[model samples]
Target: MMNSKQVIEKIKEENISFVDFWFVDIFGELHCMGMPSYSLSEDDFNDGLEKLDASSILGFKSVNKSDMILKPDPSTFRILPPDYDPSRKNARIFCDLYEGNRAEETRFNRDSRGITAKAKGKLKEFGLTHSMWGPEIEFFVFDAINIYPSPYGATHSYGGSGYSIESKESPWAKGNASTAIDLKEGYYPSQPKDTLGGLRKDICDDLYRYFGIQVEAEHHEVATSGQSEINFKYGEMTEIADAVVTIKNVVKVKAKKRNKVATFMSKPIFGDNASAMHTHQSIWNNDTNRMYDPNDSVAQLSQEGRYYIGGLLDHASALCAITNPTTNSYKRLVPNFEAPVNVCWGLGNRSAAIRVPMYLKNREKSKRIEYRVPDPTANIYLLEAALLLAGLDGIKNKKDPGDHVEENVYKLSAEKKRELNIGSLPTSLKGALDAFQSDMKFLEDVFTKDFLDAYTELKYKEYHAFAQTPTAWEVSMYTDA
Candidate 1:
């Protein structure tokens, strides 16, 4: 970890002209406020930036109580690559928000970063020091993207909302009838068929070179039309969340430089597989992996591991409200799309919500659970914190995760699923919010009541907006009826 003195000296050595303080809204959209490098001192690094009105930020505060401080975390300090900011010598540092002018002890209740910090502290109560996470970040890159909604202040516009995306790898693109990628057979294709290979390489390089994120693998994903996945090395929960936010920003900026657009929306296309951020996680003490067991021959998952999975299944529906926060997230969770809908655990079963990967030979060091339900739209801090709380609750209550299914869960009959006491995830954002309202006791230790209330209120507004909007599909089907 970099201390204030080291950070200040590094800034002087690097001659960084400006420093950008970064923080996240409830939805994980990054917000930045930059200051000239000369304006900062050792004291500023030790204390924080001046208090600002946080009312403008979503899910933060009302106009009446808007004061908050941005306390920089020097450990997250990094120099932005030239490609990301060619106009100037720029650096960025993530921040923790605190109540107005108070000591750092008085953290803002609604600050997602503060919530993550509290979640980490809770691990110590369970005799664990770290919760490691690795996410398979997937997305799609397109040559052009068009949304047919009227711009703000427009006097005239179309009657219905619509969108169109174009990609050279797509079958429908001009002159791609012969060269287009096959529908669901786009996985692991080489040079000619995978037109986005160079783009993915550029993204991976930037992630490692500028952001210090180590790339494990990069390749074309299952879906066609420029879909890609980049695997990054796992780390502690908060640090990994920081990497996730950085990865998304780097992908978008790099794609734009190539005259392309990238999207992390769960289901951007119909009739094909959608993007997902399947997360792999495990718990650890100082030097021992708490989730692994050598004596268990079948799966080698320890009792603690079983309890964690139990917690995830117990709170699966409520977790959807945070992990898959958007209305369109449900559209991707349906059956037959490789996305998980059933709430169950299994060994190496992709159809199950939590799949225990068996490929790793080093079970003691590498054993972990891959939660397949989450998509890329989630706020990283909230998602990790909520998941940890739910798991810890299971550990506290000694919740039992039922038998691990060996068969494909999606193919199981409804009667069979019922016989096994299996349940399905919430089918929509409203369903998830409803579940969250009743099942939030697990999160009480880390997430403040006020924070959750504001989150639910903000998400309900999102659901209503999407619910009330008239889509082109609706107009087309009902126009002549």
Candidate 2:
């Protein structure tokens, strides 16, 4: 809660020798650079900590063409963990990128953080105060993940026997080696069966003690080998996004120290449960919870809350381009496997894309709607901002999300589903992108046309690159013919 001047004075008082300016690209890749704490005077902090050339950081230019600026957000200041360097402890702040003139006419097209800030301002303009977000980030820890690519061949190994509780070779392996569960079936097992139990605990401890992230819980997800999920307490939209990047970094660093690899690649292993960062969100009006109503309401969700879900469901297809933004993300959206493919909300139903969790009963503050489309690979800032915008649009327009289908939607006949007005999410990245292109008015407040155009160009290039690659399956099926 300290101002920029107070933060600067505190840094000097704490004898912090250096300050690391941190930021992320549109793809959620973290970037950092350091400056001497002596250079971080009170005036400098108030004026903003500025740096040169963030073009590379924004994926806008190659090394040769890079030229941009970074200005630290004073509120994002924090002391670096002791373990990163025991001596000469460093302070850090997340930064905003800008281009061109600093005063009156700075062209800041490439700043993802700037876009998010603008989005927040727009939300305020629309009379929405605070947007709360809880991200259930899921990932897989592997004993070894080897990727090799050559002109003649390519191979990757996702270690598993399709059915196994304990790996004979895993150091964490213990009892019940003979009674292993099948692939994508490792949800909430005990010690020996859950190889990553100790690791998850260690990761959670580090997040709390080091980064100060309040982890709600950590547990095994529905994937046999090394799949896990860690739930953090709900936070302000931007704070949650920042926490996500920090959490991922901490997990990977800690895993590497223990000779393991962690991945958020949505669908790292074929025929297994894919990772998803299912987001739960709610709106608040000062001290009151706008999304909660204990009186005559379906599933205890307020009328405004239902409208928010309606907005999300209405724009769900376009939302996926930002939320489930990867080619691998599509692999997990298929029917079954507890993945929510249908665009509907229901209480205690896993088949619905939006589920009002029954676990938080009697806790008014905990009431929220979960959007299950997002994966960990998304830029959390953009995803959260877009969802907020869409939901606000729905509320503003009084859009109704309609009846909740408690029954399994997959089992319903096509005609029956049509009668019920159930719609499935986009099955491919291209489809998602196409949907975004047409139905992304809500995003315009945050994502400018230039940002969207550049992002589309970059993603399409990646898609084409993947398309040009000859997979082993293709060779096996058609090389002889």
Candidate 3:
């Protein structure tokens, strides 16, 4: 990796006409400011970028008096592909924010990227070399989405002919062999059944060419109407987070080109499977796999692997705030829907929160545990980092998450589940927030107190906003009265 000065000199030598400084706000929205290439002198680059009123980025600013500085992380610098803007040659770099004159003393508490970097550092301090992550991000493509708000009524309607699976009014549904598929049952169906197969291919191709992300595969998800998933090869924690954001952006742009709108909302349609970002993770030592064991007694997972699961289950509630943070997130967590609501792990089981994948047949290097709670709407940086910290904590304590539950947790009797010590996740966003508040230590390890407080405040505001809005259900129930 080049130093700041060297990075700047190289950019100039390469004739890059624009520099894009990238950073994330408290809500994990990616923000950027661009500077002409001529303005970025070697001296200016060495001094680093500066912004006086960075409190605005905190998403909880009232006074707006805080001073903040942005220093670019040279390792994250990459040239923008020609496809995005052909005429203006561009390079992008992720920035680290500092609050004080002494760069080492001041840290941006709300900086998601910084928190992730700190988490990775902590992992190394505990003798771990690398943390791998594979996030299966699911999303919905709608032809059109309309939102209406008023004191008397509120409703949202989504319609589109491009990706609609089936409807009496849809011409494509009536014997249109090339695009027709059974509504709500299009999982892994190739060609004709996969209506958006071409769209998925285009999205993946653009992501790989522009961002250099290695896309493993993509397919139509179980949800029949426009639900899809793209799987990227596992990368380091931070890199994977960056890739997540990039992939989302690329997919949305592709959808827009085809007159469609893409959404990562956990649950967009009633009675349809919600979009989720099921994360698969593994810990690795220096060039060695730490989670794999050929001699394991159960599911071929080593002692370390079991301990990692123990940590995740123990801290699952607290982790929910970062993993499944939105109000709609709970709608997907309900039972009998393939979503894992029970705190347990099992081999080849989709009902368990932590699933030991059976797909890694004959591939020891690919062995890892799948954490099923997260959604694509989450801040990928914070989510992956928090999981790494929790797993490390587990290893330090040598925690053992006992025997696997082979039977479906939803099918188990209440008394039987109680005997087995199986616990359910929070039923609502409010419950998740409460859980996060009670378990502050885990979050504190990676985030400053101010950042956590600000984040909680923002989320509370969102919750209340949703609460104040009248839903269509309310009108149906009250109109008769």
Candidate 4:
């Protein structure tokens, strides 16, 4: 880890032309504002901060309370890859947003990054030193996209965003297509069938070389077009949130250089797999793994681990508002495509919301639960905070997650599912909002009430906007009648 002085020295030695101070909006979108190397100041970099008008950003401020400060964290410093911008040397550092102008400043309540930091600090009460998350964010790299939806009038051209795969990258191109990986069967085939193999590899290699995120694996995910994943080793909550933003940026930047568009929007394509951010969560103190148990013969999860799952299941409905926080997010959560509709935990069950991955022998350190409902569109900072808080509630209350659903819930009969008392997640943004409004204790503990209100207000506006819009599908079905 570098101090402010060390970071400044590196920038000078590296001949950096520009340094972008990075922060996140409430929606988890990365925002960068910068200055030239001549403007570098150690006092502001380390002890003090740079100022900005937070009122202009979404979910942050009113006109009267517009002021905010950004304090760059030296540890998150990284130089952009040459391919990213060969014209000028560029580097980035993540920052936290604060509201007050005084010496003792308070973090901006709506800043997602700040809320995550507070959530991590809150873990101190449990004697847990850290919580780590690994999100398997799957996305598609398309050759081009066109999104144009009309909303105000019935006669207007309606909703439909066209996504097409480039002929060279697509498996379905020739006059007589060369066995096009058949829709949902694009998992793990190398080269010929897996067209984006080389691209994903480049992304992984660059992520490690630039940002110090070691790639665990990269592979062709289950989709025909260009769906893929570049997995990385998990780290602490705040650290991983920072990495998530960097990873998405690198993928998009690198893809654009090759004349491709990388998208993380869930359910971009119809009748095929949707991109999911299935987050794996684990807790530890120092170097000891807190989820494993040597004495327990049943599933090998500690009492604390089971309770954590319990808390997650108990609050799964409300958690959706944070984790799957988009109108498109619910479109991907439907049954039959392995996108988790049932709110139950299971061992190796693809249909269950929570899955305890059966790790290899002697790999107890890797034992953790994966929450599968979230999509890449979520704000990682707020998503992690929700998961950590929900898990902590489970640990404190000793909530027991009863009877794992080992069988495929989709295959189970309605009578059997009813017997098991299994529940389904919120079906849409409206359903999720209802759940969120009903439960505020866990969410409010991290997000200030004002922030929560603003967030929901914005989300409701989004939902209503979409809800009132006319779709091409509706026109196609009813126009003839």
Say which candidate scores most in lDDT: 1
> How do the candidates rank by TM-score, highest first?
1, 4, 2, 3
Candidate 1: Cα lDDT at 461: 94
Per-residue lDDT tens digits for candidate 3, residues 240-274, read 88888778877876887778788898887667678
Error of 3 at 406 (Å): 0.8
Model 1: pairs clashing at backbone N, Cα or C within 3 Å: none
Query: Could you give candidate 4's per-residue lDDT for residues 422-450 as a string of tens digits?
Result: 88899999899899988868778778788
Q: Which stretches of candidate 4 lie over 4 Å from their true place?
A: 47-49, 148-176
Q: For each of the candidates, give the backbone clash count.
A: 0, 1, 1, 0
Candidate 2 structure quality by residue, lDDT tens digits, 312-356: 999999999889888889999988777888888888787888988
Question: In candidate 2, which residue pairs clash?
Answer: 53-68
Which pairs clash inside model 3? 184-224
Every model's TM-score: 0.97, 0.90, 0.89, 0.95
Model 4 scores a TM of 0.95
Instruction: Give the CA lDDT, 0 to 100, for residue 188 in model 3.
Output: 86
Tens-digit lDDT track of model 1 for 130-241? 9999989999998988987752212345444568889888878888855488678789988787998888998888788878899999999989888999999999988999
In angstroms, how far off is 221's CA in candidate 1?
1.0
Runs off by more than 4 Å, candidate 1: 101-104, 151-157
